[model samples]
Target: MEKITPKVDIAFKKIFGVEENKDLLIDLINATVAPEDQVVEVTILNPYNPKSFSNDKLSILDIKAVGQTGKRFNIEIQITDESDYDKRALYYWAKLYTEQLKVSQNYATLNKAIGIHILNFISITDSKKYHNVFHITEKESGLPYFTDLELHTIELSKFSKD
Candidate 1:
């Protein structure tokens, strides 16, 4: 029998965004995020629910979780190459990062937010690397200004079974 591809957005969300698959999600996050930013465990903040999208047609099935260290993780799978994919990803990342703070909460209380994008097509065509990580840094010094925000992109088209 053929296996269903988890690369599909719904399938991806269903597999990694469930409470029962918490361990699997944690392992996946640890493998995807930077070594220094790895997490021991993660709690599914927004667990997958098919009914949740039944009313909204524009909703993207992305997995949202919070790590033991308080860092937030958003995982998304894209099979089609949208024109404004980069901007859309950044918008989602920024939304998640900023939404951590309440009206009276301090900025320091905000936790690191990471967005991981698994793309079936080559989003970054300039590079052949399957895995890429982005961080805010000083241009001349090449030093990270703040490690609070991170974005990871995995090009499935560049992946090989070998």
Candidate 2:
């Protein structure tokens, strides 16, 4: 057996390096979330297959994450901006949320589902914010419609050097 000691760097990219630490994703999940119910239950969504999506689809380079605590997280590094990105994100977000409801499951049984996008290219929107979070909300009263479904996106292009 061999033991290896590595140097440390001060950056989120260092902690969550993309090329390696694929499995460490689970660790990130474990750290970011804490559930009130059973902590024994945990699952990591892996959508790395090019064929997992449609035949000609660009394919998901990797997955964000979903937790048993009804929390979802997505961390992606994208270099290009595709058309209808807003719709695309929504489509995937809905897919993650609805996929949980099987043949005989109630709505309450559904856990929190989230999608996170790390875009390397500038988004079409004019907003200068670095991050965005989406949640169900009422139209009139402006109250959260539900806390179970969540979406988060981080724009790396806007990341500044201060």
Candidate 3:
């Protein structure tokens, strides 16, 4: 593995985008935001490296931002046509939520985590609109659920402003 120095400044803006979504993101993570709760800072973790040196050389133009709400979010810009999209989304969501627990903190102290994947691939089925949210729950009772920890996936290819 070649050692690449992380250019923390320009890379951060490129991934997160200097747009209104930055503000909207703060609201999204906090669930509801007050008018005065200005988004003070945005931190991107080290694992958020855009470069992936796997089989295919590709960069994820995605943003992993943490806001004042103590919530972490993974937003990805994906353009791929594939099956089992729902399962793939779940995998990423779980990976983010579970990885938050530190050795000292318990589940109660873990901050709310979410993985938002926005894809621009055309759907194979009749389903047109693209936003999906997922949460942890039981199969049988289906009673216990965490309202804070959530996941959202949007298919941009099938979206319409109208």
lDDT of each residue in 36-135, candidate 1, tens digit only: 7798888887533223245742334388888888899888889999998998888778767876887899999999999999999999988889999999
Regions of model 2 farther than 4 Å from truth: 1-42, 48-61, 68-70
TM-score of each: 0.87, 0.64, 0.60
For model 2, residues 1-162, the per-residue Cα lDDT tens digits are 853322112243444544365456666444433344223334445554233446644434245455556555554555577877777777667666666677888877877766666676667467787676667899898799787666566676787876
lDDT of each: 0.83, 0.57, 0.57
Q: Per-residue CA lDDT of candidate 3, range 1-162, in tens?
A: 964322243443453555544665555444423343335665665443332346733323255666675676676655556688667666555556666666888778677667766666754345655776666688898765886557665666667788
Residue 95, model 1: lDDT of 68
The residue pairs found clashing in candidate 2 are 70-112, 74-116
Which parts of model 3 are misplaced by more than 4 Å?
A: 1-41, 48-61, 122-127, 137-144
* Candidate 2: worst-modelled 10 consecutive residues by lDDT: 3-12
Which ranges in model 1 have alpha carbons more than 4 Å from their true place?
A: 1-3, 47-61
Please state the error at residue 53 of candidate 1 in Å: 20
